[model samples]
Target: MRDDIVTIEPDEGLRTWGWVSYLLHLVVAVAAVLPGAQVSIALLVVALVIDLVKKGDAANTWQASHFSWRIRSVVWAGVLYLLTSWLWLLFIIPGWIAWGLISIWFLYRIVKGMMRMNAGLSVETA
Candidate 1:
């Protein structure tokens, strides 16, 4: 069961999973909007776990050098955490609902790939 968890970087940063992460998030977001929020909640749990399992310096992954979204990553990570917890509570009760709160921090991820190229440095050095 523990194998279900995958932490590519034991003591590093977010792992690369191509653009699929965004698609997964999109699905989760839609699920949150639906009447039954289970799908979204599960997705959120997985996502939150992914973030938690990852280990590394925040200033790496080539996103840190940029003066742009790198800062946003930290903020977004925090926001995701809160939203996930809120959703966990919501899933516990049927009547309860979680207002969709889009984490603005996500933009940093898409921009992160480019920021890596633009800055020519990973989070550690930049």
Candidate 2:
């Protein structure tokens, strides 16, 4: 009988950047969900840019999935927000509910990604 052990090494630098991006995303997401606690959209933009720029560096690595995950999360949330913008123009209560739900979803994604990254696991893109 033979016994073997396998070890996986993670890129610390990429993980550091991932942590920074996730923290930024978390702040924006939390602010979005809070009433009258709006934060600058620039923080999200900065996080997105960091993901976009560092995505290539993560290619072929487990960390790549995290970058993709964050990027897709932002894109989907932005699209959903834009699509539901009409609710705000037509009615107030519905708009509040819709946006609130979207913000929560965004927050969930960021937190999930952060957890996975911390665990040194790849995020599920699909």
Candidate 3:
């Protein structure tokens, strides 16, 4: 009756940065989906800084857990955005729909990760 091909381990949880990371994810989602707002790299820098500062000198789970897998994911997001920009120019409607779908998918993953982290922490305290 179940369809999940992969099962997540119980011990792993979201990174320590937690809320800050989720907020940064929101920033990234907004920027990616609303790319027409134009050349504003400041916010992206802000997101990156927030990730680093909020994370502090703590062990890096994201960049190291999968050995830069997150880096590659972020890079792939950039690629998708760039490719979609061209598509947007070609045809406005479908382009935005695709962008919205992709953005939502990314946001869902971030939020799900955060929720699992929160759930684990709660159970630990309980």
Candidate 4:
């Protein structure tokens, strides 16, 4: 039988992948507000792809929390966007409101993850 246990090493600082994911998400969030910028969404897609590719291997590193956090944030954000997307076809105001709320939530996740990472703490898994 294979052991399912995972050990995370103790290492923290700007040298972690967690920190890089945080910065990428932050840029995507901020770039959304910029005019004529579709690049932000592309960046977000790239970040999510990286998260997917690295998450399994991240289990043995201190960066696991960050990977988990980023993945969850992306999944949640996508769900919210999709669920609220129908509102756009009906009422413009409600759609905008939903988008705004999702944006705030996205920012919150990024900020919270970054703060925890900077403080040498792992992000909350739940």
Largest TM-score belongs to which candidate? Answer: 2
In order of appearance, the predictions have TM-scores of 0.35, 0.90, 0.54, 0.80
* Candidate 4 TM-score over all chains jointly: 0.80
Query: Where does candidate 4 have its weakest 10-residue lDDT segment?
Result: 1-10
Stretches of candidate 3 exceeding 4 Å from the true structure: 1-16, 27-41, 52-73, 120-126
**Tens-digit lDDT string for candidate 3 (1-126):** 123212233223334444555566666766666756443556555655555554333342232222122233456666777778877888999888877877776666555555655554221112
Q: Over all chains combined, what TM-score does candidate 1 have?
A: 0.35
Q: Alpha carbon lDDT of residue 125, candidate 3?
A: 19
Q: Choose the strongest candidate by lDDT.
A: 2
For model 3, state the Cα shift of residue 63 in Å: 10
Query: Ranking by TM-score, best first?
Result: 2, 4, 3, 1
lDDT of 3 at 25: 62
Instruction: Please estimate how well model 1 matches the true structure, expressed as its whole-model Cα lDDT.
Output: 0.41
Which runs in model 1 stand beyond 4 Å of their true positions?
1-15, 18-20, 34-40, 55-59, 63-126
Per-residue error (Å), model 2, residue 81: 0.4
Q: What clash pairs does model 4 have?
A: none
- Model 2 TM-score is 0.90
Runs with alpha carbons beyond 4 Å of true place in candidate 4 = 1-7, 10-15, 33-38
Local distance difference test, per candidate? Answer: 0.41, 0.88, 0.51, 0.74
| Each prediction's number of clashing residue pairs | 5, 0, 0, 0
Segments in model 2 whose C-alpha atoms lie over 4 Å from true places: 1-10
